[model samples]
Target: MNYRLLIQYDGTRYYGWQRQNSTDATIQGKIEVVLSRLEGRPVEIHGAGRTDAGVHALGQVANVHLTERPAEEIRNYLNRYLPEDIGIIEVKQVSERFHSRLNASEKVYVYRLATDPALHVFERKYMTPCEEPLDLGAMKEAAAYLVGEHDFQSFCTKKMKKSSVRKLEEIRLEQLLGEIRITYRGNGFLYNMVRILTGTLLEVGIGKLSPEDIPAILEAKERQKAGATAPAQGLCLKEVRY
Candidate 1:
């Protein structure tokens, strides 16, 4: 049976989601160790997406094939062996054909920014702190230009082999007490796409770039034309829809 898992993790100490032979300190590697021990055999798991180091996830999904174990028992057993920072929120049997990565229909990611000079002690690990004030209106205008389908080559790293064409369904920005949250809902994202876009928007908010420059930037299709990539700690995989 194929088991689907909803997982949450604080990625601060781990290397990343994908397992690496060079390092075993990864989310996937850690879980696989526990699962392999439970089943008395090697168990391979597939995740919905590979999140970078320092990136957090509240709704990460994965699928693993096991021999007819009770779902609740599997969840409880995994949780018992897993580290405190990683958790299996839900688990159930899925169809043989249901894949965690390929079957995903949409993904939502949120980048957080702390605008206040004095950083909140607890939020420092999760939010990027900005010393300068942001122009919210200008940032919104710039983000509007990125709402439709386009080749996001400018916003992605050059190390990617996949096509950069993607449809962005929504880009909503909300400001709370001392923090700024930018949420991205899209069919898919390229390598470091969301972080790069957030960095560009921050440039616009700080008068370094104008909202009118967004179209031309997109047209450039060059990574150099975009702003610097934001830090990974500020990014979080908020949701994945199948």
Candidate 2:
């Protein structure tokens, strides 16, 4: 039977959601190992997206196919076998044609920044600490420039295989206390696009880049011309919409 799973994880210890050929552990590898042991057979989990190392997910979706077991019991059984950092939030029987990666229509990502000198040790795992004050208005203006369909090659890493054009549905900036949250909704993204976008917005907030420069950067389509890619720890896969 085919089963769909809603997953959440802390990416601190894993090498990402995908399995790689390294001694370093991965979230997928760990879960597969646990599930294999439970069912006495190999099991594969297909994720909707691939998050880089140290990146987290709050509502990631995955599909798995298993035989000889009831689909509804998969979540409860996996929870007992999987590690603490990775949890199966929900499970349901899905059509055999349902593919987690191909069926996704849109995704929402969030980047968090702490704009204060004092660091919260606990929050360090999930937020980027910016000791400088952020210009809220400037950040909002810069975000507006990113809300449209554009060639996002400048914001992505060069290692991607697909086209760089993407439809950005929304870009919003919010400041609460010392934390700044940047929420982005898009049809798709190239590698590291969210991180680079966050860095570019931070540059605008810090007076290093003008809001008008965003359009020009998009026109350039050269990764070197864009701002630096921020650390992956502050990024989260907020949701996936079908």
Candidate 3:
């Protein structure tokens, strides 16, 4: 039977979502160990996204084939044995054809920046502290340039043999109290793409780069032309829509 899992993890301590040969401290690795023990065979969890180290997920989805069993049993076993940072929010019997990654139609990622640290106490761990007071108007202008279909090779750090062209449908920047949440909705994103976009937007906010420079940067197709990749802690996989 194939089971679908709704997952949420802090990702502060783990290496990332994917299972690594080097360490068993990954989110997927830890969950697989417990499920493998319960089923008396090796179990694999296929996640929707491979988030980088220190990145988090609020509504991550995954699928795994397991022995015929109650979905609640699997969820209970995972939550009871999995580490405190990881939690199985929901589990359901799914079709064998369901694949979390391949079936995903849109991914929503949000980057949180603390405009003032003292005001945001509870969400500090998930947010990145930005001591500088950013120019909100400038940042929004810069974000506008990033929306739409574009080849975002300049925003990605990894060298991929496949195409880097992506359809970035929206970029919403919202400021609430002392935190600024920047949401990126797209068909897909490259590795570190959101973070790099955040960093480049910050540069525009701080007057390091102008909003008009966005076109040239995109046209460059060089990683060096973009801004630094923002810290991983600020990023969170908000949702995966099928």
Candidate 4:
């Protein structure tokens, strides 16, 4: 049977979503290890996307195939066996044709920036603190240029196997409590695209870059011209929809 899982995790405790040979652990590697132990065999799990270290996800999706267990019982098995930081929220039988990555229609990511003077140390692990007040007006104006299809080469790192051009469905900024939230909805994202975009918009909010300059940066198609990549701690995978 093939099963789909909705997972929530604190990425600060792991290297990232994908497995690697390094000493640092990863979310997928840990889950695969536990599942492998239970099934008395190896198992491969696929996630909707790869999140960076120190990031968090409220709605990460993954899929696995197994022959020994029923689909519903796999959730219980994972819950009982997996560590507390990672939890399988839901599990369902998916069509054999369904693939987490290929069938994905849209993805949403949110980047948080804390603007309060009174920093919460506990929350710092989950959010990026920017003591400098951000101008929401400027941020919104800059974000306006991000919506629609364009070549996001300047926003991403690494040369992609596919084209850098992508369709951005929505981009907006919202203030919640002491934090500034930047939400982006798109068909897909390139490596570090959202983080780089967030940092550039923050610069615009702080008077370092003007909204007018965004078009020119896009024209340049150079990664260095964009804003610095923000730390991964403030990034979260909000949702993946098919």
Candidate 5:
């Protein structure tokens, strides 16, 4: 049976979602180990997206083929065996063709910044601290150029080979008491794309880049043309939509 899983994890303790032989401390590696033991064979997990190390996920989705069992039982068993940081929120039988990555239609990521570093000391692990006050209006204006479909090679990993074209559906900025949240909804994202975009927008917020620079950055399609990739701790996969 193919089982679909809703997963949440704190990526701080592990590598990215994909399993690796180098380190067994990955979220996928740990879950696969437990599931493999349950079936008396090796198991593989297909994640909707692979987050960078130190990132977090609130609605990561994955699928695995397993022997028939109650979904709740599987969830409980995995939860009991897996580390406390990795959690299975839901598990259920899915279509044999249902795939977490290929079938995904949208992904939502949130990048949080503690604009007032002194205020969120304890929450530092979940957010990036920016002691400098940002120009919220400037950031918003710069974000406008980012909405809609575009080739994002400038905002992704420098060594990308696949097409960098992606449809970025939305870029919403919200300010809480002392935090700034940058939320991105897109059909998909290139490696390090969201973080790079955040850093570029932040540069605009700090007067380093004008909003007009966005068009040139996009046209250049050069990684150096964009700002630095933000720290992984500030990034979280908020949801995967089907």
Candidate 6:
């Protein structure tokens, strides 16, 4: 049977979602270890997205094939073995052909920024701290330019070999009590796309980049033209939509 899983993890310790030869301390590797033990054989699991190291996820999705087992038991069994930082939120049977990555229709990522000078010890792992005040209006204007479908080469990493053209369904910015939350909803995102976008928007918000310059920046398609990439800790995979 094909089972779909909803996962949540604090990626601070893991070496990203994909298994790595360098380190067995990965989200996928850890889960596969438990699954392999449970099935008494190799059990391959597929995730909806490969979140970068230090990035968190609240609603990550994955799928795996397993011999008939109670979904609730599987969830509880995995939780017993999986580390405290990683969890399986939900599990259910799915069509044999359903693939987590290929079947995803949309994804939402949010970046959190702490604008205060005094850092919260607990939030240090989840938010990026910015001491400077940001111009929210300017950031909003710059975000509007990025709403439609465009070649996001400027916002993507230069190492990306795939097509940079992607549809950005929405970019919402909200400030609450000194914490700035930037939400991105899109069909898909290139490598480090959200972090770069947040960095560029921060530049605009802090008077370093003009909101009017966004159009020209998009047209340039040069990675150097964009701002620095924000830290990975600030990014979170909020949800994956099918």
Which parts of model 3 are misplaced by more than 4 Å?
none
Instruction: Estimate, for each residue in 1-242, the C-alpha lDDT of model 5 and write its tens digit.
Output: 99999999998888888888899988889999999999999899899998888889999999999999999999999999999999999998999999999999999999999988788888788999887989999999989999999999999886677788999899999999889999999999998899999999999999999998999999999999999899999999999999
Per-prediction CA RMSD (Å) = 1.2, 1.6, 0.8, 1.4, 1.0, 1.3
Pairs clashing within candidate 5: none
Taking the tens digit of each residue's C-alpha lDDT, what string does model 1 give over 180-240?
9999999998888999999999999999999999999999999999999999999999999
Best first by TM-score, ranked: 3, 5, 1, 6, 4, 2
Colliding pairs, model 1: none
**What is the TM-score (0 to 1) of candidate 2?**
0.94
Tens-digit lDDT track for model 3 on 171-210?
Answer: 9999888899999999999989999999999999999999
C-alpha TM-score for every candidate: 0.97, 0.94, 0.98, 0.95, 0.97, 0.96
Pick the TM-score winner.
3
lDDT of each: 0.94, 0.87, 0.94, 0.88, 0.93, 0.93
In model 3, the Cα lDDT at residue 162 comes to 100
Which window of 10 residues has the lowest lDDT sum in candidate 3? 115-124
Error of 6 at 106 (Å): 0.8
Which regions of candidate 2 are displaced past 4 Å?
117-121
Q: What is the per-residue lDDT of model 4 for residues 1-242, given as tens digits with 9 covering 90 to 100?
A: 77888999999878889988884389999889988887889888999999987789999999888774676688888889888999888988889888888899999999888787266567787788898877889888888888899999999889767899999999978888788888999999999999999999989989999998999999888999999999999999999999
